[model samples]
Target chain A: MKRFRVLDIVLGILGLLTLLWIWHLVTMLELIPRVFLPSPAATIAALEWGLVNGDLLPQTLATINRMIQGWLLASLVAIAVGSLIGVSAIARAYIQPTLEFLRPLPASAIIPVAISIFGLNSSMVLGVVVFGAVWPTLLGTIHGFAHVEPRLVEVSRLLQMSRWEFIYKIGLPNAVPDILAGMRLSLTVALILAVVGELLTAQEGLGTAVLHAARSYRAADLYAGILLLGLIGLVSNYGLAIADKRILAWKN
Target chain B: MAQNAAIELKDVSLSFGSNEILTGIDMSVEPGEFVCVIGASGSGKTTLLRMIAGLLPPTTGAVLLHGKAVRSPTRRVAVVFQDYGRALLPWRRAYANVSLPLEASGMPANQRPARIRQLLAKVGLANHEDKFPGQLSGGMQQRLQIARSLAQEPDTLLMDEPFGALDAMTRQTLQDEVLRLVAERKTTVFFVTHDIEEALYLGDRVVALDSNPGRVAYDIKVPLPRPRDQLTTREHPEFLRLRREMFEIMNKIHA
Candidate 1:
């Protein structure tokens, strides 16, 4: 197993090297303008410079804070509402058509409406982020709660378990795997909305920093900000994956 | 003077709209009695068990527990269903699954550990307390289900084809285990199964039902001695005679 892990690391480094080599080749050949895409060294230098001088860290932190706030809000509401609809047939029938209609509407499309109401502030950005981030979690949670095995329901009944006890012990645990999967999707949505919200709202976030760099033709800074965003995405995705593994250790 | 029978079905009849499932399933189980209901696939034996467990109400007549009509599942009763895969919570460890009923009873947190361990050990799963139900084998999962049910310490257990899905060897082992446990606790059991031999071996009395509007066709006592061995019990004259009689009745129903 240790050897296999070592092999995997080796292969991962090799894959990175291959991608970097491709980028180097593309720059050397001038297939794309240097103004449009900076070289790897130039991008790294700009990243170092920004860390040393600019508000790179602050902007990144701001974006992340907004993401956490919005993501948490979405998760709490979606889980609450999803479980409600999942358990009650009457609620599902009444609310399903509206959810179906709204789920398909692009989350980004609501930014203008949010901006008009909340007007270029954290609340507006948060509203957009929450709007975009909620669908995956809501849909996944509803599916999870609806599909708890019938026999388990019978077992709960046989135990003469109270409604609260049944939901807490059985319903919630059963929905967890699906709920986690939904959160994973919601994380991606949160990141996208965070960046989009910043760009639209003219907020002081990594997305705004990238927009600023690009507007001024600072290709290296633009690439550096974009790279940092990508890295954040990677780190968060892996973090959630590790958390999922730990939480669902009982599962095969 | 009270009847004190653990369960009584008073001419219980069930129908889904016009589709009659069971008709006149009249029976009474003495306290601590082991009664097995056996029949073919469409015999509604499971439906009868469900009625006694109060999962389904009889369309006519009533299912009573200790002379009181059963409206819903009560704390005094527990059910061990056939689908152990679905019955045991996939997210829970073996010990936690056994602790579920204890927790529901609002037992003190400090006292749960020993009780959970005791029940797990009773079902032969003491060493596997931390393993999840998905990791356990089919037989082991069934054992976990039994352990969970036993934790309730219910006066009556309603088993719906609890051993039907198991392989032959596992089925026999579980049958013996269930008998030993129930005997020790003096828990009244209403075991439903399609296997005639299983019914005879495990039951004090076998109530055989016929299909197509299911109703009791044969009610016979198993006079075979307790502490029955798989080999010697099968070899016993009474066991074979009862088996032959049940076989003929089942055959006639099929015909």
Candidate 2:
């Protein structure tokens, strides 16, 4: 594993170097203007300047806080409602059409309405993120619970396990992998919605930094902010993947 | 011996959506009696065993345990299903699977380890206790399932084709081991099988069932002596006679 990680890092460095070389060649050939497409060095310099002089760190923190709160609240509600629907056929039949009606409406489409209701605040950002993140988690919970092996359920019942015991022992354990996969997917969607929310209405955050740079024609700063957003997304996804591996180590 | 009748079924009948599976099933098993129920596929042998284990409800009649009707599965009656791979939980180690019944019984935590060890040792799986069912071979996994059922200290054991998935050699060996263990524990067994030879080999009394609304077609007693070995029991005159009789009964049922 250590050898593999080292090899991955080496390959990554080579890939980055190749990209930089191509960029240098393109810029020297005047394929794009310096104002339109800043070099990597210029972007780095802009990143350092933003980190030192602007409220970049604070805005990043604010974005993260809203994302976490929205994602967690949405997950809790999704699991509760999804599990209820999973166990009861009548409940599923009654609620499924309404959920279907609501799920497909894009979270981004709700931004204007949220801005009107919450007045361009964190609440508006949170509302959009929650709307985007909840559906995958809810569908995951429903699928997980609905597909529990009937034979295993019979075995548990034959053991004279209580309803609570059946849920904890057989139900929850079987559903963990599916639930985690949903969570991972929802987290990615939540991150996208967070940036979208900020870009649409917020006066702060990396999205705001990017928008400001664009308006002022600071191409380097815009590129740097976009890079930072990409890095955050990559880190979040990798972190969730590591967590999933650890929890489901028993599986192949 | 009469006082040791662990289970009794009085006109026990089972139907699924108007199709009668088992009808007019009356049988009594004494404590420690290894009674094997043999029939063709879909003959309701498994259903009868499930009813005895209280995993299935008899539609019209009742299954009695110690003179009381059994409404649901109780710890006193445990079943080992044919699918050993599916029977044991994959996430749990062999010892944990064996200990599941004890855990469900809510036995104090302190005593569980010792009980699990005892049962695992009994099933000759002491060395493989830490391994999961996936890690073990088919025979080893089935042994683990047997150990799990035995951990409940059940008065009656209902095994539905427990050795059916095993190779012929492993099946015969496990059959001998199961018989020896059953003899030691003196637990009443309702062993279901489609194999006439296996039924005759392990049973104190072999009950043959006919297909299509399965009913007991014949009951033959094995007069072979106790502590019988594989070779000696197969060579015994009574064993051969019983095997022939069961085969004829099955042949006629199919006809």
Candidate 3:
């Protein structure tokens, strides 16, 4: 199994190299106009320049800060509300339909509503991100807390545990695997919403950078921003995967 | 303590909508008594144990603990479930799993470590205190569950086929260990199992249940001697006779 994992990483790197080669070939062959699809080399040059003497690093940091703050807010609210709904049948009956209705509504569509509330600033961007990123974690928490093994429930009951004690000792710990999985998914949603919020609100982040670069026809710079966004997504997902592994080490 | 029964059920009946699970069940257990209930599958043996533990309320009659009607779970009774894998907290190490009851009862943080350690040691899990339930073998996991139950410091234990999932060899070892521990602590035990001989080996009295709305069919006392030897006790004339009787009754119920 360990051997497979090592081999798996090597295979992943190979697959990435293959994709890069294809992109390079496409640009060199002029399969698509260079102005529309920048060469790999041109994109890399733009990325280097942005990091060395441009506002790319700060832009990247701003986007990350906004994304993280929004994700954290969503997660705290999700877990609190999810736990409440998960533990009670009556609450679930009344609230689940409303959640189902809101779950699939587009976050981008909510931008105008949020702008009206928070006035087209960072808070509006934060609001949009929170709205989009809250669902997966919320649903995951509800499922996890609700589906705790019946035998454990019996044990808890026999111990005569208080409601607070039951949640702290059993409900929360039991839901860790599901909650983390939901958080991982929500992180992706958060990054997407953060970029969208930044673009529309004219916030100083990668989304605005990408949007401004497109208007000026700086294809390489636009591609560079896109590349950085992809990297951020990959890295954040990897970090969470490591955390899930550490937390669920006891799970086979 | 001497005057009141440790556990009592008077005409206890339970129904889920239209289907009856248990009906007209009446029994009593003295303090420190080891009573085992035996039945085939769907005999509501587990349901009966749940009622005694106050996890399920009977549709008719009452479950009494120490002369008090049990409407809710009492801290004085600890439950050990058959599926040790599910019974235990997978995230917690053995020490922390045993600390659950103590923590729930608000034991002082500074004082919990010693009690947790002692409980783990009592269940022969001292060396594996840091191991999670998933890391332990079947027997070890069940031992961890026992340690967790013991942490409650309960006067009575309600065990639902706890050894039903173990291999035969592990089952025998745990049976002996349980007998030793229960004897030492003088804890009243209500043990449920489908295994006839296991019921005979551990119980001071064996109560057999009939299925299709479970009711007590037989409640026979075991006249076997104390400090039972797993090998010799199985071969004992009275043990063999009682085991045969239980087997016959169980088979008849299936028929």
Candidate 4:
């Protein structure tokens, strides 16, 4: 395990170096116009300017906060409703069709509706992020809870566990791996929707900052914004991966 | 008579829709007696055990326990399932699996540790307490399942082919452990298995069921003496005689 962690860091550095090398090559060769594609040096300077002089820190934090808030809300609600539908036949029958219908519609398609309701605000961005993020977590949870073995169910019954005890002890724990998997997917969706919401709704966030950079033809700022977004995604994913390992240590 | 009976199936019949699984399964188990039911795959042995455990309802007649009709599973009854892999909570360590019933019974937190430890140690799983069910071998997992059931402290133990999946050596070992445990605790056991020899070995009486509208076909008292050894018991004249008779009957039924 220690060897693998070191190997992972080495591989990560190698990947970053390779990406930077490619950016340098593209600019050095003048393969694209300077205005359209920024030099690696220009992008770094833009990153410094954004962090030191611009609102990059606040904008990045704002985008991440919205993502976390929406993702957490979706997780809590989905875990409850998904588990309910997973275990209860009546609930599955009643709620499944609507969920299935709504799940397939793209999260981006709801942007217009959200804008009309909440109107160019943080709430509108949140609504969009939550709507987009809930499906993966909900569906994953249902799948997890539904597939719990019949034998375990019988054991629970034989043990004379109360309704709540059975659900908490057996149902929830059995669904953990799936729930965490869903949460990870939802987190990804949350980030995407957060950006999409800001871009479309003209809200103040990293997404809006990126959109502003692109409109003004500030290619260096655009590259820096995109770089920051990628780093945020990588960090959050790493955090979740660590958590998944710790929580489900018994699995493997 | 009914009050003294640990379990009684009075003309109990069960059907899934129009298809009958068990019919006229009339049997009685006295308190502390071990009864084994043997049959082929579709012979309703498991169905009978389920009825006794109150997990399933009979289409006709009644399943009674301690003079009361068995309607649903109670704390007084516990079951050890055949597929231990599925029966055990993979997320929980062996100790917590045993602690499940104790916790459910609303036993105090402080009281649970001793009981859980005792149950795990009873099943010879003391060293494997921290291991998850997935980490254990099939035999060890089955022992964990047994430990969990024992923690229930049930008056009646219903086992459905609990050792069917284990190898010959593990099967023999578990069989002895079960016999010893049940004998010590004076717990009433209703064991269902496909193996006729196992039925004869562990049971005070062996009940064989016929398939195709499954019903009791034979009921034989195992007059073999107690504290049966793995080798001597198998070699006993009475054991050989009963084995022959049961093998012939089972063959004829399959034919």
lDDT, candidate 2, A11-120, per-residue tens: 98899789888887777776999898888888888888888897777777776777778888788887877777876667777888998998899888888888898888
**Predictions' DockQ, in order:** 0.84, 0.56, 0.75, 0.81
Let me know the DockQ for model 4: 0.81
Grade the docking of candidate 1: high
State which candidate has the highest TM-score.
Answer: 1
Give the fraction of reference interface contacts each candidate recovers: 0.93, 0.44, 0.88, 0.91
Docking class of 4: high
Error of 2 at B92 (Å): 2.7
For each candidate in the order shown, give its overall lDDT on alpha carbons. 0.90, 0.84, 0.91, 0.90
lDDT by residue for model 4 over B106-213, one digit each (tens)? 999999998898888888999999999999999999999888888888899999999999999999999999999999889999999999889988999999899999
- Candidate 2 regions off by >4 Å? A1-25, A52-54, A112-119, A201-203, B1-4
lDDT of 3 by residue, A1-252 (tens): 999999999999999899999999999999999999999999999999998999999999999999999999999999988888887768777888999999999888888899889998999999999999999999888888888887778778877777777777788788888999999999999999999889888999999999999999999999999999999999999999999999999897
DockQ of 1: 0.84
> Model 3, DockQ value?
0.75
Interface root-mean-square deviation, each candidate: 1.0, 1.4, 1.2, 1.0
Worst 10 residues of 1 chain B by lDDT: B2-11
Q: What is the lDDT of residue B71 in candidate 2?
A: 89
Residue B191 CA error for candidate 4 (Å)?
1.0
Model 2 per-residue lDDT tens digits across residues B141-179: 999999988888888899999998889999998998898
Off by over 4 Å in 3: B247-255
Candidate 4 ranges beyond 4 A from true positions: A1-16, A200-202, B1-3
Clashing pairs in 2: none
